[model samples]
Target: TGVASGIAQWENNAFPGDRLDQLDVTNGQVFVQKVDGPVQFFAQLGAYSLPDLGSPYIRSGKATGNFYGAFPQWFVKYAPNDSMSVLAGNLPTLIGAEYTFSFENVNVERGLLWNQENAVNRGVQVNYTTGPLALSFSWNDGFFSNRYSWLWGSATYTINPSNIVAFIGGGSVNTETVSSAVTPLYQNNEQIYNVIYTHTSGPWTLVPYIQYTSVPSDPQLGTAQRASTFGAALLATYALDGGYSVAGRVEYISSTGDANAGAPSLIYGPGSNAWSLTITPTYQKGVFFARGELSYVKATSTTPGFAFGPTGTNTSQTRLLVETGILF
Candidate 1:
């Protein structure tokens, strides 16, 4: 589900120099998921409306990424045997699923550090597992820049059910040398890696994860060249007997990328490294559920124009959110 408010201080700061009233309402989303024997599928469609705050003039538009407010995805998986499985269609990024929970996300929005390059690769991934040993690989049509063809493979070892770790990494070589339509970026080749560790004991689950991505810089956008971000989320969830629970998440984010080299500035050099802590209390009974959350984003970098847009540029921001979801 999504949340909206009458007073939004994030978009375009001072209301983009246009507003018809002192009040507004936001829209949420709806989705459904199911598992039929060996096949599983899920999808969601969300719609939202708010101040179309004018573009705040910045050297680089790193502050926002086309703020087009729609989140939709669907994927289908098939299992023909115990050691083999296949997935086809548009699936969520693997790194995203391993890092954060869908519910209890402090802000309605996700960060910009790397999602900009998280191509919604549409294709297939294969996996095989055998008594503590596993191998997985995938082939996808490049969705990030429309140039790179990403074929990935990985090997895994599972110590135990609750205590497990996977060291996954992949590489994308440029299959098409088309000039970047959005900028002058000619992504020649890139390497990506994910280190995910998950442990679940009784009522608590912990995941200490990291992702490293390297993409080329488009000189036309004043590209901050070769940028990367280091971040972690410590999530603690407590489940109740019935259908109620509370989760707390503390996240720290920092960027190690150039923000001053990209073309015209849409290239998104790293935003100011920041840390945010959020907690969400939720309750659900039957077809109804509600969650109340609060978040605090603290800017650690003094970059002049890099800000989440609370009031001005390059400052801290705090957001309060409440979301309710239902199924029929």
Candidate 2:
């Protein structure tokens, strides 16, 4: 499988390293997977970009080069029976409802809650299913730090045919100091939890989720004080006639601690909070598709030098984006 996509974006309150308008390739990637018998493998290769609300955008070229390289994911799975499987290598994280790539999500950009979750990790995982319950557990490097000191797990329960619920939690067992374009030091050592519910009916799909993350006070880890964030998001999509669909997302996140306590800035600033709304209308025909999105974000109690704009004083931002692509 392969996908190619391009994006044109216009936004206000540009962050320090961001521009007001830009055009770039969003996704040009190939996926290979083999699923049969007792052995299987999956791999994703090439370049891709991750766009999200309330974050500065990175171009596809730099995103691929600086983050996960040309091969973002590659894993081998061994299924010994119908209910048991073991997987190892670079695998996608099970901590969030949204995926890492642009083409795998419902909206053009990810929500605020997605910012606090890990996207991928190198590790070993065990999966098992019995009746209506599916479970998975993994031991991996948190935040791609390559130190392999994190434990993660997820469980999903099917309730009837139209609804499902899932619980996910993960955290680092030891402190990690590695920081890079793909890893944030504080977040790598933090604990995270999520509760998600999904509902589907005739032509509509709805998802609601809540997230919590806590970074403990550890001087050795460079965190002077304990800090945490609580966030909630709702994502919904509706299908219309003639290959048309509409999707929207709403999110709110609030951080704990303040400047007086020297807490790490998890969001806009210590004790700062933010909210965002996004709407995307899409049209698809066969392997071709197009989508336009409008999103707005606002911050409160933001620090003077850590918010938005050229000088980092703006508290609000609005963005317009259009994406066109083909999946083959």
Tens digit of per-residue lDDT, candidate 2, span 1-328? 9999999999999999898999999999999999998999999999999998889999999999988889999999999899999999998999978988888998889888888888989999999999999999999997888999999899999997899999999899998888998898888999999999999999999999999999999888766789999999999999999999999999999999877877898998889999999999999999999999999999999999889899989999999999999999
User: CA lDDT of each candidate?
Assistant: 0.51, 0.93
Candidate 1 lDDT over residue span 166-259, tens digit each: 7766656543443432222322244567676778888776766666655555444334475545556565667777787777666665556544
Superposition TM-score, candidate 1 onto the true structure? 0.68
Regions of candidate 2 where Cα sits further than 4 Å from its true position? none
The number of the candidate with the highest lDDT is 2
The TM-score leader among the candidates is 2
- Candidate 1 RMSD to the real structure: 6.6
